[model samples]
Target: ELGLPLEVAVLGVLESGYDARAMSHKGAGGVWQIMPGTAGHYKLRITDKLDERKDLVKSTRAALLFLRELSKQFNGDWDLVLAAYNGGPNYLRKMLDQHKKKTFWEVSQVPGFKSETLEFVPRFHALLHIMKNPGEYLFKIPEMEQAEVFDVVRFSENISFDLLSKYAGIPLEMMEELNPHLKENEALAQVNFYLPKKFGNLVLKKIRKYYAKLRLEKYRKKTLRVVRYRVRKNDTLLGISKKFNVPRGRIKRYNRLRSAHYLRIGQILKIPIYRSVKSRGRVAKKYRRALSRKGAYRVKTGDTLSRIALRHGTTVARLKKVNRLKSSFVKAGVLLTIPSTAKFQPYRVARGDTLTGLARMFGVSVRAIMRANKLRSRHELAAGKTLLIPDQGS
Candidate 1:
């Protein structure tokens, strides 16, 4: 609804190279290079667990909202608005007051305004010019891929990505890649995260099942009480263990801490305290059973062995050995045994399709597609070829 030009979106490309994770030394971040204060004012959450300034869509909306306010403040003087965006509003106001100029062109004569701010308006204009006359300037921008569709999953409290990946039939890495706004390796329960639209419902469905089982298990182990602890300065797992009177190894395993030194200040860690007798073998046995539920997944178009392996938390080599596959390739409609539980579907290749493109479309690796199709590098694939798609495999 803002009156800002639609082309203003391109400004993100110049500011942060269109990288949501881009951060400057002065604390500007995201595609729009929004400062911390501006991010807060625009309601982009920044916390130890999540920094929404690193979120592509949210940050862009925040930037546009900020620009709209600036436009109104500057009385529709886009030059001054752009200048204030580069410098701060205070800087432009000081320049205006010192020079007694009512407009940006007059304020440009002031001494305090930085040289970069002076040229920023012209730079934006030049960008617009170039975009409008790309062929005239002999610029041939390559085609860009369409944006990925997403479905949002909201959490009320913190959840472990490790557990979610295992039971939710999603790859941990894929979840991380889609949700780059996360400050740590895990997702904060306070915010909603996005997954591929195709897999969102599946993941949510699996999460409910996994958590239901977990709640039942917790009820059975009535002696266990879950405690949330925030790490303080110079806190170590060993020190925390001593303070809590729990084994350091148990803490590590419970928290999925890969290393003893992987502690962060202000990061929350879950500590399970036992009120009654200590239970040992049963816990480990239950965990093994939960992780080892095996099933079969049929191959589908664009289905890759590696992707299947990842979804099931197995290695590609393990999957091949289990299926007794001599070659990397498998035809669509063929059923493959999953190391873990999963489902399967089928797809047909269309014209102008590349293996790499297909991999990206389904969020798998190109090499995986190659192996599933028994194709080598530079192998030719025919259009209209049907393929089997595995659900939640690698």
Candidate 2:
């Protein structure tokens, strides 16, 4: 873990360009993801290559041998070695890694790296770490979408990767990726490459096209939003609410959280603040609506100006006016006037309704409702108290 070792330390920055096998939007081979035929021809036997993929020496030697072949086949130039290594060297039909068709290095230093290859460069070090010490690499690995297709079988050495993929009815591309160490795509020769069948093959087709296009999309990013924060140890819902000046309830609810209990170490919790649906709909949808007098709130104890403001979608100055007060102070029992957290109809709390319960029904959180009405408990949720329940994601 201290220093990426070659067999277990060096990232395939030199071999597979340091990419992970499953997750990266970059659909290229990973640190040890040698192509099936190449792996077999190189004699990198797969006899359960699972943990072996992490074996530093084994993968390193295999990668080195593969690179050597690519070097010789690709005119002794490093570019073809890289291109062949990045995509498939032979896929070009004897074309070298340096084939003028846009090598991996050229794309990186020049074409900005293919979208799938986009993650390759930066992941070199990460691959190195995982290989060196898998335990420490848990968090380092990207949150993969779970290929759900990590198994294999043994067979003869005649079935082509393409042909086996055809028989397995799996995506030829994914079938190849899954059995990287398979030689000549013939997997176990006549036995063929084993796969997860329909779903497995389906995922292969989907990911190949999906992830291949996913490369470098960040470059085309559309929005600069108040990125959501994941909760880590020692972080309180209250503490986060204060820092962002958002009411605690809003923070909890915006994240669609069930209870503070679900708040785990490293849990990704959205900030109380949100951008409008203009954002691919991944986050809560926010829309602008006309204003009304009905939506309002007041200040209370444990009430910081920020939380109150966030709860009602109003600022401190406006909050001051709605109540016709100054200094932003209201006694523990005193209520301060404020607006809705987003555009929406306002209502008073009714009996049989807990803040958490109401928030859940309305897609708002107990914290959001509590903050809107300035309730200290955030969970107590009282009756007959008017509170603004903004439209969900607003």
Candidate 3:
């Protein structure tokens, strides 16, 4: 409907091999291999949690609109538009102005034409040619398979796929096969989940059950804070409890960890820290200033105050003094207010210091490093930049 040639869709094939979620090293993503900047220009939503560039139909429509606009800009020269799409229009225009090339064919011989752009038109032409005359090329194309019919189910909260598979009566393998758009073990909130048409009723029924559990009155309270902890190697329930200054029994009850044996590497545990008036009342007025300067810590699977103090450039004595703690005993989900000192320490990022390595070295979680630095997963840690290390559990 965009008044473009049918053969123009071949660019999609060349760009992404028709993979909707295809992403290039240069951050070009989706079926049309649109860069973030181009996707923004076309009004595609791109965020850490959501990327609409991978929506096949929307991306195709956007691609068509962009191609049409480019065609008009190049004065109906589809070849030049295609070339300009491969190389930038501005770069091509500058080359044209410098070399006095009136057409794409003339520009192709010019030195300014990129090597990749030089082959782009020919590749598109070859794809169109092959598609038009498959027999002439001695190629026998396979019939396209029909797409599976599925019903869309939206979840407002993040729920693990294991729970979803069990409750919805869908096999875990089938869920994985159907939801290729989802990352491995992801439980993204407020997203549409595609299920087989037959299981629509089951999915809806389970959705209610799933959400009913989340409607607890305690969860609605603003005073409670939740932290996520991933169990690292050789992590124990006792060690984790001591690190956060909470009871081990409460930790087991909160996370539903029946036994210490159930603890496994990379197992994510939810740590709930209560921040109430009672907890705050324990600290003295003089210590309140220390608490004010302190960073909040949500205990993780294997954290210790020694490690925490080392990471934050503080001492255990100072931590106890600041928090007015009677003992070093901590729980996994308990929030510990670590007092900050006059000597605020910031660690400079060094070469080969990845987030994971730093987390392990500092006895904190990777998420803690991210949270402390206000960073997202895609953010790169440049060497020599100071990163504020949180003095407690993540």
Candidate 4:
């Protein structure tokens, strides 16, 4: 453990009111208000599926290590360390050199010093004082309940958090709250899942039962076929899933893919092909009707023509042609026409489009919709915004 000052723990209260999910407009996140660059420098994982900055245990360790390094740079002067942490260390060092000051108070008087950084140090000290002597400030800190002990269960294969919650007899929301690093409902293989110590053995026993059920199902289902397929150039998991009429999760599970984004060309994969008893005539009719329909898609933040096309199972050329778009650029809130399909449809957020209603209509979970659009909360759903309704199989 780093030999940090006891008062350093109070920094979380000042940074984010001890909220692990807190995010600042400046891109700092989590209780420690760590920026993306700082998290990367400390080797904290930040990926599309996982952000360790929101993990209390990992982020706390990274923050302390960072603070310890800053302490060394400032020669154990916590005041300067705090200043450098708020304002870039390089900026603080430059200010110190220019002003020939050894302390934060002196350098803070310099003209170029930011007001935010200037107040940051004093704000921390004030909070530390108030925390140490709460009675003097007429603040009655409530006693906290005993902390719940957690047990980590590592999985060799990808599993749904929904399934875990059901098996462990824990609420889905509680499971997500306990495991903030998982961006989606499905926990990736090899990742350690933290569960209450009481439910650890129960979860393991249920997982074994689940596997037994899977084996039995496989044996009983005569229509199930295992086909060997080689990964091709420009092949994506989504593309492969679409081609085989399989869910992305199933494809990942069968192949034991750790990261869905990484698929090597020439790699062999075992694809489970479930033969349908229904004739091809019915499917053909459905496909023709789907192609005849036109749908509207509302552009959201970080939308690109290519990405939008991919999500909707179309091409950039087709999207541009349909929308009559002169350029590849698509701005947020812009409505574009798309060819309607059963798998992926676009729906505008109506005045009364509650998160629950939309999820119910799409036959998906609220969390699934939120995860798809990178929405932190249900409140992010606003009227007139376009939302991508994912396929139920997805």
Overlapping backbone residue pairs in candidate 4 total 0
Q: For residues 253-326, write the lDDT of model 2, one tens digit per residue.
A: 45656776555543445553333334443322121110122343434558777677777566777666545456
Candidate 4: Cα lDDT at 171: 84
* Sliding window of 10 residues with minimal summed lDDT for model 3: 283-292
Model 4 weakest lDDT span, ten residues long = 284-293
The per-prediction tally of clashing pairs is 18, 42, 9, 0
Identify the leading candidate in terms of lDDT: 4
TM-score of each: 0.54, 0.23, 0.49, 0.54
RMSD of 1: 23.9
Tally clashes: model 2: 42
Error of model 1, residue 256, in angstroms: 30
- What are the per-residue Cα lDDT tens digits for candidate 3 across 1-394? 6778878878988888888768888788888888788888998777665565776655678788888888988999888999888887888888888999889889899764689889998898888889878899999878776674776676777767798877767788877655545665444675656677777678878778766666544543542544445566788887666555446776786776779666765455655555553356543232233233336666776888788778877788876655556787666755576554543236778777788876764556778778777898725799998887664432
Off by over 4 Å in 2: 1-30, 48-51, 93-394
Ranking by TM-score: 4, 1, 3, 2
Clashing pairs in 4: none
